[model samples]
Target chain A: QQPVQSPQAVILREGEDAVINCSSSKALYSVHWYRQKHGEAPVFLMILLKGGEQKGHDKISASFNEKKQQSSLYLTASQLSYSGTYFCGTEPGDYKLSFGAGTTVTVRA
Target chain B: NAGVTQTPKFRILKIGQSMTLQCAQDMNHNYMYWYRQDPGMGLKLIYYSVGAGITDKGEVPNGYNVSRSTTEDFPLRLELAAPSQTSVYFCASRGTGGSGEYYEQYFGPGTRLTVT
Candidate 1:
């Protein structure tokens, strides 16, 4: 089944912070996060395995709670380049990923 | 090296028409996937291949077909296209593994198809 994402859309100013959440109806083995710009392909950010772990990049971080069947993406000190759609892909089983509807994030200068 | 490439950036088809979207990756990845993105919605997996000659259906695999004759090529086929199938199609590939036990996928530019 497809996952559900919260906050269909969000607007933020430079240096602001935002959180995008994705919840799955079924159990998940791993969660993958991606960012897509307009008219472009989605870029992989990070992946969290079952153990309810957390991963982070320069200013982007994500946490996966297998028991909760959900994951959250955190953007710290957002930059203009961070304006895009965030999608969380969940692997329930069979190594197949079901992605969420996505969260549209806009970061203004 | 060209990470991933897709053919026919845009296309139009009528009901019952058939077409093929070509996907190729030069990174020699072992995993490839096909997904469709509708307006205002997230991507829906149509099919995926773990390696050459091995293919499997994804969440929304109905009305579509795929072939993985080689590792570098994975093409999606639409037979008797319908208006509902109109969407942007993307192809992605992931190498064997990532440095930290994660697999990062690289996507193609995508093929936009409109059915009239």
Candidate 2:
């Protein structure tokens, strides 16, 4: 099943911070985060395996709570380049990923 | 090296028509995937391949087909296109066990198809 993402859209000023959450209905082995710019492919941000782990990429980071089947993406000190859509993919040990609907983040100057 | 490449960046198909979207990867990954994204929506997996000659259906597999005849190419086929199928398609690839494995997937440029 597809995961559910909260905050369909968010607007932020430069240096602001925001969080996007993704929840899965089933147990997940891993969670993957990606960012997509307009008319572009999604770029891999980070991946968090089970065990309630947390991973970070530059100013962006993520935490996965396998117990709750939830993951959160954190955008810290947002930059204009951070404006785009964020998607979280849930893998249920089948090697196939089910993606969330996505969260649109707009960072203004 | 080109990580992943997709053909026919944009296409318009009339209802009932058929077409094929080509995807290729130079990363020599063993896993490839096909997904469709409607405007303002997240991607929906249509099909995926574990390796050459091995394929499986994804979440939204109806109205589409795929083939993984070689490790480098996986193409998606759409038959009897409908307006509901209009969306942007993306192809992705990942290594098997070593390196990135399934930890990360490299995506293609994507093919936008509109069925009217």
Q: List TM-scores for all candidates, in order.
A: 0.94, 0.96
* CA-lDDT, candidates in order: 0.92, 0.93
Looking at model 1, the pairs that clash are: none
- Candidate 1 CAPRI level: high
lDDT of 1 by residue, B1-111 (tens): 999999999999999999999999999899999999999889998999999999999888999999999999999999999999999999999876544455778999999
State residue A7's C-alpha deviation in candidate 2, in Å.
Answer: 1.1
Q: Can you write out model 2's per-residue Cα lDDT over A7-104, one digit (the tens) per residue?
A: 99999999999999999999998999999999999999998988898988889999998889999999999999999999999998777889999999
Weakest 10 consecutive residues of candidate 1 chain A by summed lDDT: A91-100
Looking at model 1, what is the TM-score of chain A? Answer: 0.97
Shift in Å, residue A71, candidate 1: 1.2
> What is the lDDT for B69 in model 1?
92
DockQ agreement of candidate 2 with the native complex: 0.90
Per-residue lDDT of model 2, residues B1-116, tens digit only:
98899999999999999999999999889899999999999999999999999999988999999999999999999999999999999999987685434568889999999999
lDDT of 1 by residue, A1-109 (tens): 8899999999999999999999998988889999999899999999898898899999999999888998999999999999999999998645677889999999999
Model 1 TM-score (2 dp): 0.94
